[model samples]
Target: MSIWGKFAGAVVGAYFGGPLGAVAGTVAGHYAFDRELDKEVAFTIALIALSAKMAKADGIVSPVEVDAFYRICRVPEGEQRNVARVYKLAQEDIAGFEAYARQVAEIFADRPKVCEDVLDALFYIAYADGTLNHAEEVFLRRVAENFALSEADFSRIHARHNPNVFDPFAVLGIDPNASFDAARSAWLKASRENHPDQLQARGVPVEILHLANDRMAIINSAWEMIRKEQFNKDV
Candidate 1:
């Protein structure tokens, strides 16, 4: 069965007894303990919950942004209602985003890369409306902090999604004055890290591997721009 199918029958509330559990309970109507709840399910729930919180951060939830969440999550037609319920429940939950972030952080404590993927997913939703507002940036930063992500980590992810600015160096998380060899190494490492296969192996749901695809595109673009710039300077 697909992840959504499993989610429908899984006792998510019992599996994660917190605001997230409340979301699952309210949506699934199941409160029985589910020891089989896997990291993929937790990742999906965290993404949806965080995405919902992100939509409300700027005080104006754009339809475009909501559409982006649906697209990023790849919510199926049959499961849209259930997924929507989760989103709505998350938004209405009294606990702040910090609570959700902390839960996610703990769940993926050993898999820090997955936490970065979560931040990337949020960035995708945040910029879907064409811009990242100040409020949204602050919210994302707080989420990153809660996830135990470093400032460099946040900047690299932010640079990848921030359409207003294109800093190749920032995107690659390398210094502007780095040698071509160093830049190439950075690009290679980033590409490997953001590769879909790597993400899947690290527990990101297959449904959302497009997050890696999109990020790889951004990383490659930055690499190409830097390569060309270096060639020009060498000439």
Candidate 2:
């Protein structure tokens, strides 16, 4: 079945309250949505739904951001309407975007890497136009703050999306004055956390999982640069 087919009229959630529940309540019936798939659906809904609110946060949605959304979390053809349903619902929700963001943060509280992925998605969208507007940057900064992502982690993700101005140490969340050992340790830890298989195991959307490959490469490149410049070594 198509990705959308799994959730069509299948109910986004049960009796849970708030915008999350409201979006889940759209099913309009006591349909027993697959419990396993429910988790995945929640992941997708949270991503797209929050992105809808984010478009509003910045007061305008760039075509590049929209395109980045499609690329980063691909929805197969013929399922656009299903995705649109949740997006529209979120944009019109009475609840604030932070409320939804908090709910999502709670849902993935045990999985910080997943939360990191969420932040990564937001940065990807915000920077899609090659420049993250002031409002958009502030909004995303609030997201990272809410997610409890450290400044280093947040900047690392930011650096990933802007290649022209990417700071290698920033990508690894370290200072150039740091020891090589510290840099190496940080790189290894981040590498393991960002492996595609690890992300898939954590229930990330497959497309997002694929992004780990690129992230993994970026991390390695950062380490390589740091090594060559700071340690006189090749990774």
Candidate 3:
């Protein structure tokens, strides 16, 4: 079934907690059973499904957020309404977002990189209005937990969107006071994981995969900062 067909059917299950459910009701007569959705399809749907909830979590959905969201989703102009319909449906769905998060997590369970990509997409939207508010941060952290993302992992990703301070250690997902060798190892691992080509190879869709460019840039900037700090300290 197409992504919308699946969502149209998915309104029945609280376990799905996704599109079609009412702000206080369930998706009307639909498939009682869950269809096996393609990972790619699921990926797209989840983006639409959870986005409204994320925006609402912050208490205000700005025009800028909406614009950033469309750009991140990269839905073709022709298909914009279809994606918007799902986003509206999801916003109206009252089921806990945990169900939606779980569904997405299940599809990418064995594919952690894909899960991270999902988080990256979510982060992009959260920052769309120019700041990550308290509600949005709480909402995203829970989503990350549902995706089995570690606190350190979530922190590193969050640091990219919210760089209030130039803390290289947080960007590298390492302890600030770590030994030089430990920091170097952390940077190498970050380099390997966030390399644009490597992320694309991991099955991240092209639209979302380009986010790796930003990730790589952040890692590179963090590493360079740390490198200079270390070199000057040694000299």
Candidate 4:
């Protein structure tokens, strides 16, 4: 309630000849206002929690990720003044992230188009400020994957918002092959695409480039896995 609204309610209650009446009226007004604020808080907190989890996906959280969230969410300074509240909310949100995800899934159930909108919003958050860290990208894809969103839907959402960065096969620019050179080339390409410095130049701050490194490692590992399979088949 607005200040004036609360004051008016309190005044009316006070006229009824009991101080407790005014107190109760004020409390009621506050409660009503708080409910709406709570919803907004919950929504924002949920997004932050999702973002944090995404940041942790590549195995480390960075100040850059945190900064990206603040910038993308446009969380105001005064609201963020309550750092403890924000932190606590973030924890609570993370604890309930899956629940919220499920709830959203249910809410948009039978409404594929609406679900796409939700996914789009999520991708916007996930890629806000020009880059999605590996963890963030993986987390986003997982979210879509969990929903079993159609490949078409997934592709549309991804293409609309995410980077076309570091496609492992594309990086290597070669088909899976029997030659070691092919695997090595793929790794080299992926590593170059995900080079830590390149990430920084692309607006992924130094702190968050660790995710790029982690992704590079994944590309290497995948190459190794494919190489082993090819070698085994040849044997």
Q: What is the TM-score of each candidate against the true structure?
A: 0.94, 0.88, 0.81, 0.43
lDDT of 2 by residue, 7-45 (tens): 553453442455666776663534333334355556777
RMSD of each: 2.0, 2.6, 4.6, 15.1
1 or 4, which is superior by lDDT?
1
- Per-residue lDDT, model 3, residue 94, is 67
Q: In order, what lDDT does every prediction score?
A: 0.86, 0.75, 0.70, 0.47
Clashes of 4: 1
lDDT of 2: 0.75
Report the lDDT tens digits of candidate 1 across residue range 78-124.
Answer: 88888888888899889999999998898888899899999998998
- The digit string of per-residue lDDT tens for model 4 on 1-235 reads 3222333343233212122122222333332222222222223333444565565666666666567566555544544543224333444343434444554454335443334434554675566557777766667766676566766557544654535543434324455453777676656765675576754443333322344554556566556655666554331
Number of the top TM-score candidate: 1
Where is model 1 more than 4 Å wrong at Cα? Answer: 11-14, 232-235
